[model samples]
Target: MPPYPYLATDYDGAAAHAAIFMVQWKREGDSLARYLVRIGEMTESLKIIQQALEGVPGGPYEYFEMRRFEGLKDPEWNGFEYRFISKKPSPTFELSKEELYMRVEAPKGELVIFL
Candidate 1:
């Protein structure tokens, strides 16, 4: 059996290799084997988080685009304005009459929406 089944195609290759070794050595229904795979996945996730944190650029982290709306006031500050707050009403949109379908991989399972 292939470790990391067909549906797990989006996962990292190194993790899949590690899973292959675990699957080859362990019994099919072993709880400890499952726990170890979970641990390995967590470790891989932490490594990814660390790399992302290191790559992040130094900040004035907050950015807000200055937008012009009929009822809103003009922004007071030029660069990195801290006091500006704008609340605009949501714009109306027109959708086509045709059917719309969307699918997303949720945590528990696949989620689908149809309109």
Candidate 2:
């Protein structure tokens, strides 16, 4: 179980809290910058996840069966690549452990955001 309330009323507040945290720490400037960048990416991922759960026509799962792409890596990303997978609307689950992929080629990027 998660600590935060899983109600729709709490998502935006939770996300805002997280964004503020990330932004506050973003000023550290170093690994923090990278971390902040990834956090931003994750924020977008969460938006996608929420939309997916809310009956959006196409969601991440439609493009890749997460497990199938778990070990797959992109060949051209420098940092992280936010790949969008499409799928029919469905419920969302809380994630525990998940493997992510990254691009192997020049400008390597994150190829997956597992949550």
Which number leads on lDDT? Answer: 1
Give a tens-digit lDDT track for model 2, residues 49-111: 664455534435454455544565643221233333222111232334564322332346434
Error of 1 at 35 (Å): 1.5
lDDT at 72 for candidate 1?
Answer: 45
TM-score of each: 0.33, 0.23
Native-vs-model 2 lDDT? 0.43
Candidate 1 structure, TM-score to reference:
0.33
Q: How does each model score on lDDT? A: 0.47, 0.43
Best by TM-score: 1
Deviation from native of the Cα of residue 88 in model 2, angstroms: 29
Worst 10-residue stretch by lDDT in candidate 1?
14-23
- What digit string (tens of lDDT, one per residue) describes model 1 on residues 1-115? 5544223356544333222222334455589988877787777566555654565566564333334233445333332332332122123324468966555557887576668
